[model samples]
Target: MSELVDLRTSGRTAVITLRRPAKRNALTIELCDLIRDAATGAVADGARSLVVTGEGTSFCAGADLDAVYGDTFREALYGMLQTLTTLPVPVVAAVNGPAIGAGTQIAIACDVRVAAPTAAFAIPTAGNALAVDPWTIRRFSLLAGNGAARAALLGLEKIGADRAHALGLADRLGDLDDALAWAAQMAELAPLTLAYSKQVLNTVFEPELDAATAAELGKSFDACWASEDFAEARAARREKRKPVFRGL
Candidate 1:
């Protein structure tokens, strides 16, 4: 039994709710692994569609600072992201509130995203001196255009649901219940057809980075996470003010 996540199926839809409201459903290694298992298990349990949401206001506030910020955390998180995307069944991200940093990655990995009025998305990697993988950056760029992508990645701008929908980052606007209804409707579709289409569409334009490119990206990410700017971000969070980043 997973302590951090709740998986319950209703008819042909499986609902996976992140249960740690106190921490804004921040993704821990255990929680991320449970989500991966839930994705596979949901399909095995006859769920034709899956809905992922948070228990409270926050859909997911990104990685848990207490345990995340390390290579192990990134490995688990990247694994979970792949699970969300590559599962045989369609995954709906019910963004009920703010989805920050890595949380935005999870939503983008899903087949569809329906965000509520209160839901907002941001990937403030620059503020923390962190960098996402090449695939992630490419996906964001392709999904919302270069300007929006640069806004989120470089400017650290928060894109609300309305802007996200206009930018093609979010498919619709609604609450979790609306998201569940949409998933239930999708459940009536042909499984094999959906599966095949998902595979083709997802892989059609995916660019594979060469060995050197991939290694360089990893090294860059490591360097950023280990930088002095990252430490200032943490201190700023505790101090409750803007983080003054120095390009160290």
Candidate 2:
């Protein structure tokens, strides 16, 4: 229902497009909530499959820098990503262009990805002195590989569409049309079976955490958000210079 996101249904397939080309469809708290609603709305509208894509040259550049450090931003972000992952029907990403940071997380949250030649994925959190949730790290490693994860997360390398497909980050390399077609085909499958398999896969892959481990992970993630390095990164952006992180 939000102007920032468009939802349309064709037969049993629903398409959700991020519509802010001016900002490369970057996520804001509002945008994240809209996306989460769109996914749920599509399913409620009898959609058996869903395709997520962007309206512009970039799928999503990342979160808007101005709002990225807000207290509620992480909750909004992970809520949307979790909705995508837990959706009853299959969700496919049509990566039309660069999917950076939270954008990469969105793509991975989907059940399958169809990337355009221009599509590339990267989570430059380390470079920006930020951190992603643990589920994102695990999903990236499982979908791609631990080696690819190390390269992207540790080495700070961008994985192009071809490399993504080869590394299993992308299930296929194709354009929007191809992605839509794939979604339509998936819609024809038995809904209950698809939902059952999806639930099982998600449950089996999830890691159970005790209170101590959970507290530690939360502390670490919160530290990055509160760190002086993140402040420096924002300052550097405004100053039009490279950030010098002290890891403080």
Candidate 3:
């Protein structure tokens, strides 16, 4: 099988590309492990910055449903997300297309996002009968807003790149060339300074803002599990029928 992720270094910048286009670059366990290794290696190799992007049409469609439906795989997936959160160097997401569900999670895990004009963002977990991870929900709320994040998660709304930029989900909206230019600029900064700055920012954001948001997300997940829609969807799926989710 082709490698799930590709990593390359250009000068002081490391570019990590999600390569599973056949699956819309979904975050699979193997793919997540590759990303974790790449991020760690980039820092160890003295790279000043890391840029993550998708290889083809879609940036990422989220977690691989077939994989995550298994409880063990779901836990592994969450562990990978935690690994991303702990990366030492600044991680920049070069969003080239649609980023939904776990795709949005990965982008938000990065310190910044540079999205293409054609890119779109969404998190339809509530509608899809799944719950977004706690960190993802908090990160989204911090990057965008509680209201905007709720709209995407709870209301299942999709926002275009322009709107995402305006809402603070994306730092810039441009093409691959623009993303590369921005990454080059970031690579020029002192590595220690960049790392320290990212550390300080995370320190201030995590315990205060993110902690509370994460707790709320857990509550939301519990609510989702207790909902009638969850049971109905489960039943419908087993019966090989289309689920009419009411989002109860």
Predicted structure with the largest TM-score when compared to the true one: 2
lDDT of each: 0.88, 0.94, 0.80
Off by over 4 Å in 1: 235-244
Q: Each candidate's root-mean-square deviation in Å?
A: 1.7, 1.0, 3.1
Best by lDDT: 2
Error of 3 at 179 (Å): 1.8
Q: Write model 3 residue lDDT over 224-243, tens digit each, in one string.
A: 75677867767776787877
Ranking, TM-score, top scorer first:
2, 1, 3
List runs of model 2 lying over 4 Å from the truth. none
Q: Write the per-residue lDDT of candidate 2 for residues 43-114, one digit (tens) a residue.
A: 998999999999989999999997885579989999999999999999999999999999999999999999
For model 2, what is the alpha-carbon lDDT of residue 238? Answer: 89
Residue 67 miss distance in model 2 (angstroms): 1.8
Report clash pairs, candidate 3: 62-102
Q: Which ten residues in a row have the lowest lDDT in candidate 1?
A: 201-210
Better of 2 and 3 by lDDT: 2
